[model samples]
Target: MPTARAIDTSDRHPIRAFLDLRWGGPTIMLDGRAIDAAALPGFVALDADGAIAGLITLLDDALQSEIVTLDAVQAQAGLGTHLLELAAERARALGLGRLLTRTTNDNLDALRFYQLRGFRLHRLAAGAIDLEREADPAIPLLGRHGIPLHDEISLIRVLGAD
Candidate 1:
């Protein structure tokens, strides 16, 4: 498994390149607007050869944070978990108090993944992705498990309690 660490703005250019290429721009469209992901705080997991294997992007406010995106280039080797751990650690260090994120309803894997890591299903926005697709037409009509990608599900994890 690769080691995960915080990356600052000085590292934006390369991280932007990786993230933009993954989704076709330096922005991730959510709820009908573009989020400049490169500007957010992030963590990168690098392999033995120093190649990036995973990434997590986060946006924080005075009291909490939102995990904008999380990705693992390789599967089933614990890269995603490492990145998630780093995000949670950083959030605690910052005293953010909570961490939350949203995923499309069809993403059963993401739903299971976050729940297993202590995130709880917090909100449901029915048919929200349809509006999201209106703003960013690149969204596919279907997603994992052949489910229609129409709703948004928010999941949250509260920190600093123990």
Candidate 2:
């Protein structure tokens, strides 16, 4: 299993390189807003070889922490879950009440993954992806399973006192 650690300034190069390779650059569109993943604070999971196996970036606010990006180089390896767990821990440490994330309508895997891990559907912003595409034309029309990526689904997991 890979070990997860908090992302620091020294990780900028690898993080940006990883995001650029996987997501076509660190700027990700969420809720029609452009967010620079490289600038956010989050966690990274490294394999035995000390190579980045997965990473997650978050935006912490007054009320909740939003998972801006979460990706594992290899699926079914528990890397995603580990990163998510760390994000929740960080949120709680910051005195935040909730952990929130958004996924596209076509990302059925994400919907299942988040829901299975205690997240509940909070909102459905119809046509939100369409608006986002206006800003980032690279937003694909079709996503996993060949489904049209059109809307945004928000998920939230409320933290209990720890």
- Lowest lDDT sum, 10 consecutive residues, model 2, at 27-36
Clashing pairs counted in every model: 0, 0
For model 2, the superposed segments whose C-alpha errors exceed 4 Å read: none
lDDT of 1 by residue, 1-162 (tens): 787788876678878887876756668766666788878887987779876678899988898788898989887678888788778888899978898889999999899999998999999999899988877688899988999899999999988653
Candidate lDDT values, in order: 0.84, 0.92
Which TM-score value belongs to model 1?
A: 0.91
The CA root-mean-square deviation of candidate 2, after full C-alpha superposition on the true structure, stands at: 1.2
Root mean square deviation (Cα) for candidate 1: 1.6
For residues 49-134, write the lDDT of model 2, one tens digit per residue: 88899999999889999999999999988989989999999999999999999998988999999999999999999999888888
